[model samples]
Each structure stands twice: as C-alpha cells, then as structure tokens.
Target: MRILLISVNRERMPYPVAPLGLAYIAGALKAGGHDVRAIDLCFSTDIEHDLTRIVEDFPPDAIGISLRNLDNLTYPSSLSYLPELEETVAIVRRRTPVPLVIGGSGFSLAPLPLMRRVDLDFGVVGEGEGSIVELVGRLEQGASAQGIPGVLIKGEDGFIPPLPLASFHAPDRSVLDNERYLKEGGMANLQTKRGCPFDCIYCTYPLLEGKKCRMRGVGEVVQELKVLQAEHGADYIYFVDDIFNYPADYTAALCDEMIAQEAVVKWTSFVNPRFLTTALCALMAKAGCQGLELGIDTGSAKMLRAYGKGFDKEDVARAARYCQEAGLPLAVYLLLGGPGEDDATLQESFALMDRLNPTAIIVMVGIRIYPDTALQKIAVQEGLIARADDLLEPRFYISPLIGSERLIETITEAAMKRQGWIVPGLEINISVPLMEGMRKFGLRGPLWELAGRMRRPRMRPLR
Candidate 1:
C-alpha cells in the first residue's frame, strides 16, 4: 500500500519541531513492504494547497495523520488546534478517498472525540508502527480491517490492543528535512525510549505511550546520535523521551556508550528528579548533555504527594544541587495548581524555586485535565467537570483553595521579581519571543538556558 503520512503540528512558539514520530511510522511501513511518503506541515506555508498538490501528484491507498499535541499546552491563550486539524482532514478527504488513519500522542489522548470531530476513517491509538502495517495489509487485501489491534474504527466500540514499545525502533530520518528542521529548531531531536513509568497526576505520556518504559539499545541510541552528528550535521540533540533518566541503569549505560564512542552530539531531556544522582549528573555532562529539564512540579512535599509525583522536596533539591555542581544548565518546570493546592503551598513552592536558582523556572498555573489521569478523576469528583465528557477542547483543573484570580495575581507579581521564571499562559511571557529571536541568531537546545542565564533574584520585602 502506498501511504502518505502528514504531520499536523504547526505550533512553533519555542521552535518548529521535526516530525520524529511520523518518521518512525514511515520506517515501519517501509520495513513492512509498503510505499511510504510524508509531508511535514510544520514548515508548510499553505496547508491546503500544498497538501492537496502532494495528494494530487502521488495519491496513496491510505493516508496517516499524526497529531502530536492537542493545543498550545500553554495557559490563557489555550489555543486549540482541533479546528485546523479538522480543516486539514477536510482538504485531504476532498483530494483522496483513501483510508484516513489518525494517530500520534495527541490523538491517543482523545481518539474517539477527535474521530467524531475530524471524520476520519480510522484512528490508531497509542503506537502506530505495528498497527499501521497490519492495517494497510488488510486494506490492501480488501479484507475486513476490523478488530486490528491499536486501531479505532468509526462507529466501532473497541480497538485492537497495541504492541509493546520494545517492537518499535528509532525513527527513519530520510523522509524528514533534517537540515531545515535543525536550522529552524536550532537542534535535531532523537528519542532513546518510549513510555513513562511515573504517575505524575496530570501527565498524558503514559496514556499515549504506555506505563512500562521501553528503550532502544544503548548502541542503537548512540549509533543514531552518530548519524545525527556526521550525516545530519546535528551538533545538538533533544532526547524527546518523556522521562529520560529513569531505571537509572539504562540512563547510565546510554551515557557510558556516548562516552566510549566519543559521540560529538550535545543533548538534553526531561529528567526524573527521583533517580538523579551527582555521579549520573557528572556522567551526563561528560557525555555531551548540555542541559536538563527538571520535572520538579512543586516544592511543597504535601503538594508533591497531592500531585502524585514520586519525589519529595529533598529529592528535588538534591537533584538541583547535582545539576548545579556538574555545571549542567537546568530548567525547573513547576505546575503550581492542583488538588489541595492553597496559598501556603503556592508560597512555599515560590520560596523553594527561589532557593534552587537553576537555569530557568517554567510555571504552569493550571493542570490541563485529560481522561483517565489522577487529575481528571479529581476534577470529576469535585464537580469541576463531568466524568463522561471529552476533554479535547481544553478543560483545566485549577485549585479552588486559592482561586484562579488570586493565584495568577500572586504568581505574576512573584515572576516579575524573578527573572527567567516564565508563565506563558497568564500573560505574554518574554521567553517565547526571546527564544524566537535567539533562534534567528542560531541559538538552540532548549532556550530555557537563556532564561536561566538571565535570572537575577531581586530582594523584596516579605509579604
């Protein structure tokens, strides 16, 4: 089957992302003896015209659409991409009558609702590699494609179960514009593993990729890094893994391989504070990791428990110190409001962030609730939202303990005093525009470093 894969992510606030997910699927489809081609809409000037022309010239028997995110995932603006996605599907449907199969991390979050909205012929929930190939076979044979695992059919009740993450491999970079992506993005991206084992309350990673962590071989990962360096001319890489440092041994082994091979690619990723060690921090820096995004959601231990994170205040502080001592740039990400969140916890978290004084602090004020997450359950039980409702349109769970108004006001006042601390949701934060400008000047690899370097704690009277 000839398949045309489309990447529908156009949000380029931080930077235009290379469609790594679709490339992986394209590789799998090719390995399965199928003709595969892809068009990344991230850089497309005209979505409809370009997409239509691409379809007109080399129409396929099937089309796969990858939706990487539901929204901007920022606050206040809370821009929804559903309408744009709907239009993209409409354009494709007008051009081709082939099977419209939707998959990707975002689609996995609200597949059924998205199906209803987009008029897709089918949806591939979670991982699409194995499911997509099996699907194409059935479609090509003109056989009943129903009951295929990991596939969601319109008007169908259940989907076929998905294969394990171990079955997937690193993405195929041939279909991508590596140089262009690297130029605009300031760095290339690679995924070393799939899945997230952590029970972060509002996280959608596990729902998208599953709870069990599945990793590519250390050699496989390093070899890809070498390719990025030599073939793609990639100097910086971002390991798009949801949680990179987990199962400590794997992280260590991967770092060791990079050291042994002397791979000349610097990278960064989201680090699980629970397992971070000073030794591991030193190893990562030695292995060409330029920075780390610390997923320390909050500082208050009580709030940490309420947020369902596995780490405590001590764990977070220890990890911060390790990164600091290792001289690794760190971006501390904090989600302030959740169940049991109050002014005290909020203030405490603020104080703690002030102490960490890492590279940058990204503050997300409200928790965007997704189906089946602990946050979603709490939102439903608290009558914040209906349990049966689809949350595709952006339903955020803000703690009533402090109220959104006061919470935003306090945080805004606090962030003004602290440079490099950004809240992109509430107001127009400087990071977005600043990073975009920096990218123009050829700076990349998680622009949070810019924010961190700009951070200068100002002395203010205690309230």
Candidate 2:
C-alpha cells in the first residue's frame, strides 16, 4: 500500500514540534512494506497547494492526517478549528479517492465527535501505528473491517463501533521527522511506555493510551537509544511517556541498562511527583537524565483533589527540590482555574509558586472537556457545559465560581511579580519566533507581545 501522512497542526506555539506521532505511523506502514510520504501543514507556504501536490504526485492508497491540536487558536480566545480542518479535507478529497483517516493527540480526545463532524473514512482512536498498519493491510487485501481494533469505519448505516485496542510493536525512531527535527535542534521523541495510571481530569493521555500503563522492555529501549545516537547523531531524546516514574523498578532498570551501554543520551520525561524521591533522582541523574516536567496542576490540595490529581502540593515542592539537588532542571505545569478554584486558592498557588521557584512555571487556564474525561461529567453537573459536542474546539473556562475576571487579575498580579512564571495567556516573551509567526498570520498583535514579556522559562519539577 502507498500511504501519505499529513500533519495539519499550524500552531508552533511554544516549540517547533515535529509530528512524531504521524512519523511513527508512517514508519510502521513502511516497515510493513508499504510506500509512505509525509507532509506538514506548518512548513508549507500554502497547505492546500502542498496537500494537492502530494495527493497528485504520490496518489496514495490510503491517506492519514494528524490533528495535533484541534484549536491552534486557543479556547475562550478563539473558536472552532473544524472549518480549517474541513477546508483541508475538501481539498484532499477533490484530488484523491483514497481512504481518509484521522488520528493524533487532539483527535484521540474526542474521536466520536470528530468522526461525525469530519468526512473521514475511518478514525484511529488511540496509538495509531499498529491500527493504521492493520487497516492498510485489510484495505489492501479487501478484508472485512468488522474486527479491526481501534478503527472507526464509515458505512451507509452510520459510524461503526471502533475496533478494540490491539497490541502491537513499539515505534522505531526512524519513522519520525528526522531532517526537520534535526534542523530545529530538537530531541528525538521516544515512548518507553503507553497509557497513564493517574486520571488527572484535564489530561488526555488516558483517553489516547488507556489507563493501564505498558512499558517496552528495558533492552528494547536501550537498543533504540543506541540506534538513535549512532545513526541519527541524536544525543538528546524526549521520552514522550505518560508517567516515567510509575513502576519505579522499570524506570531504574532502563536507566541502569542505558548507563551500562554507555548510551549517554540526555533525556527528559514527564514524572509523577509522588513517586519521585532523592534516591530515584540520583539514579536518573546517573543515567544522564537531563530534566523532568511535573504536572503540578494546582498548588491547592482542594483543587488537586477536585481534578483527581493524586499528588499533594507539598510533594510537588519536594519533587522540585529533589530534581534540583540531583542537577536536573524542572518544568512545573500549573493549571490556573478550574471547578474548585477561587481567589483564595489561586493566591495560595502563587505563594506556593514563590516557595517552589522552579526553572519555569506554565500556567494554563482550566480544563477542556472532551467525551471521555471525568471533567465532561463535571462540566454537565456544574452547568459549565451542556453537551459532549462542545468539544468541537477548545471550549474552556476559568470557572464561574472562580470567575474568569478574577482569575485573570490574579494571574496578572502574580506574573507581574514572579520572574520564573511563563503565562501564555499573558504572553511574557516578546521575541519567540512562533509569536512572530502567529502575528504574521494576523492571529493577534501587540497583545501577544505583552504575553511574551510576561512569560517565564519552562521549569522542571522532578527527574
């Protein structure tokens, strides 16, 4: 089968993210002896024109498009991206008759709603490499699609039940954006595991990879890192795993194996604050772990519990200290306002921020409710939202009880004082080229400039 993979993400908001997910799927299909081509909407002069050219030239047997973010334009600030997506799809449909499939981190969050809205022949609900490979094979052989896991097929009857989640091989790094990633001076993204056990209300990981965490063998992980270093000259890798700290023994063994092999690639990963300790931090540092990003969504334990985050604010501070002690940079992720948030709690968050003093603090506002999260239920019960379809784009809030006006004031006052906090809504950094790009496209102007200056560097909480 000949395949064409398109990444439709245009928002290079923070960093120039290459489409590792699409690259992995492309690689898997190619490994299975299919021809593959990739196109990123972000790099094109005109996405429609480039997409037309690819469909004409390659004439793929199947087409896979990734929606990394549904709203490249942020929520509350902007609305539905379906129009942009629909426009892209129409152009592609006009050029080719290939099966249209949609998958990505963004799409995985609300698959059913997206499937209904878009003119897709099928949709991959979660990790797409294995599912796409199987779909292509079945389509090639004219096999019945009834039993394929993780596949949502369009039929005259209506959308069919998606296939059950199927087990498959881990993605090899060769499948991702090598040249672009290299040119951007970015680290290769590797997933040592799938899924997350923790169910933070705002998180989309569980919806995409399931709640039961699965790890690749330590030997497999080591071999892949060795290949990345030797073949691609990749000295840095980002473990795009949900929780690198859970199943501590696996993490330790993987680190030990990397150290033994002298595969000293500097790596970063998401760490669970509760599982991290000083000894574990020491082991990670020994293994050449560069930094860790902790999802400390709130400094208020009440807010944390409301969001189903299983860590306390005190543990968050301790994890930051431990990572810093072990010579690791820490990135702290903070969610500004959600259901249980109020002025007092947010003030406490700022006080906690002063104490933690991470390398950087990312303050995102509220949770975006999708079809599967507990947040969706909460959204309904609280009358914050009325339906699942509200997730067509990033419909979000700071919460009425917390009150958007007050939340913004609180964030503004804290950011005015905190040198280490980076608030995107506030736009603290003026010179980030991505901001320039957004301005060039008429997204926003001096407002973004204000945001740039107010933003702080990224902080890591644990190794």
Q: Which structure among the candidates has the greatest TM-score?
A: 1
Q: Give stretches of model 1 more than 4 Å off.
A: 427-432, 455-463
- What is candidate 2's lDDT per residue for 91-157, written digit by digit as tens? 9999988899898877877677788778998888777777788888899998866666677777433
**Among these predicted structures, which one has the highest lDDT?**
1
What candidate 2 gets wrong by more than 4 Å, as runs, is 72-81, 155-176, 388-390, 434-463
Please give the CA lDDT of all the candidate structures: 0.85, 0.73
For residues 217-278, write the lDDT of model 1, one tens digit per residue.
99998999998888989999998888889878999999999989888568899888989999
- The superposed Cα distance between candidate 2 and the true structure at residue 331, in angstroms, equals 1.8
Estimate the TM-score of every prediction: 0.96, 0.88
Show pairs that collide, candidate 1. 75-425, 149-160, 150-160, 359-452
